[model samples]
Target: MKLAIMQPYFFPYIGYFQLIHAVDRFIVYDNIKYTKKGWINRNRMLRDGKDVIFTLPLKAAPDSLDICERSLSADFDRNKLLNQLHGAYRRAPFFSDAFPVLEQAIRFPNDNLFSFVFNSITGICDYLDIKTEFTISSEMAIDHNLKGQAKVLALCEKASADVYVNAIGGIELYPRDAFAARDIELKFVKSKPVEYVQFGAEFVPWLSIADVIMFNSANEIQENMLGEYELV
Candidate 1:
């Protein structure tokens, strides 16, 4: 089986989904330590023809707490986020079709950070018609203490994966020789440049998947998803 693993992210960019779609099984690495200023709880969105940021508030926890152990702040108002998205993308061509999916995802009842983000990720995948099987790292039997490539190899072993696919950014982090020695092929996926009309302005790239869904139909988006990457 082909496998890919990544930290859970809230409304991540299209490349994130491309990585998930490229693999047979995608693992959400929720047992890892939470990092400040990371993409785990925040992502970029397009507003007024420019990039803007949005984030999920989390309850205070030790810096070392695993992502699965963290909780959303009780003070987070789901309606406020929905309002923000509506205000920004209400005029988007496909808002009516896309907003309900975003609403259901953002309003997920679980306050745990990982659970909320995982639901959002899976929710979007469903809308996009991606059927890759998902696994949670915390539920896997592999030793979780191993860092970097060691942990990745262990997880691949546990999954019986002969091919390990990762986002292109991981090229420098994983040694090709090590994976080759284990009879596992390592490959990276680089998303081809994708552009679409957005309010008749110069295209903004790398916005959240929400923006893409708002401006494009499900079929168009799915075609873009399947055609927008090359394995390197």
Candidate 2:
């Protein structure tokens, strides 16, 4: 089986989804440390013909805690976020069909940060018709204490993965020789240029998968956007 692993992200970019779609199984990391200013709870969206960031507010907590250990802020206004999305994409072409998915993800009642983001991811994958199986890293029997490539190798071994794929951003972080030694092939996914109308402006790239959905039909996304990637 081909496997890929990544931290749960809130409405991450298309490349992230491409990585998931490129693999047979995807492992979402809930056991890792929560990142203070990363995509764990935030993502970019296209607003006013420019890129803007929208975030899920989290309660105060130590940065060292795992993502599964964190919780959403008690006072997080789901309506406010929905309103913000509506304000931004209300004019989008496919708003009627796509808005509901975003609403469901934002209004998800779960307080755990990982659950919230995982809901967002799975919801979109369903809409896109991605059939890849999912695994939670913490649920695996591998030693969670290992870090870096050691941890990855352990997870791959546990999954009986024949090949491991990753996002292009990590090309420098993983050394191919090590995987070769383990009889596992390592490859990187790079999204080819995917452009579509956004109010007919010049065009903004990598806003969010949410942005992509707002402007394209499910058929368009599944047939064009999802497969618009190459394994490098």
Angstrom error of the Cα, residue 175, model 1: value is: 1.2
Q: Model 2 reaches what TM-score against the true structure?
A: 0.98
TM per model? 0.98, 0.98
lDDT of 2 by residue, 129-226 (tens): 99999999999998899998899999999999989999988899999999989999999998899899999998999888989999999999888888
Off by over 4 Å in 2: none
Q: How close is candidate 1 to the true structure, as a TM-score?
A: 0.98
lDDT on C-alpha atoms for all candidate structures: 0.93, 0.92
Clashing pairs in 1: none
Candidate 2: worst 10 consecutive residues by lDDT?
A: 221-230
- Candidate 1 lDDT (Cα, 0 to 1): 0.93
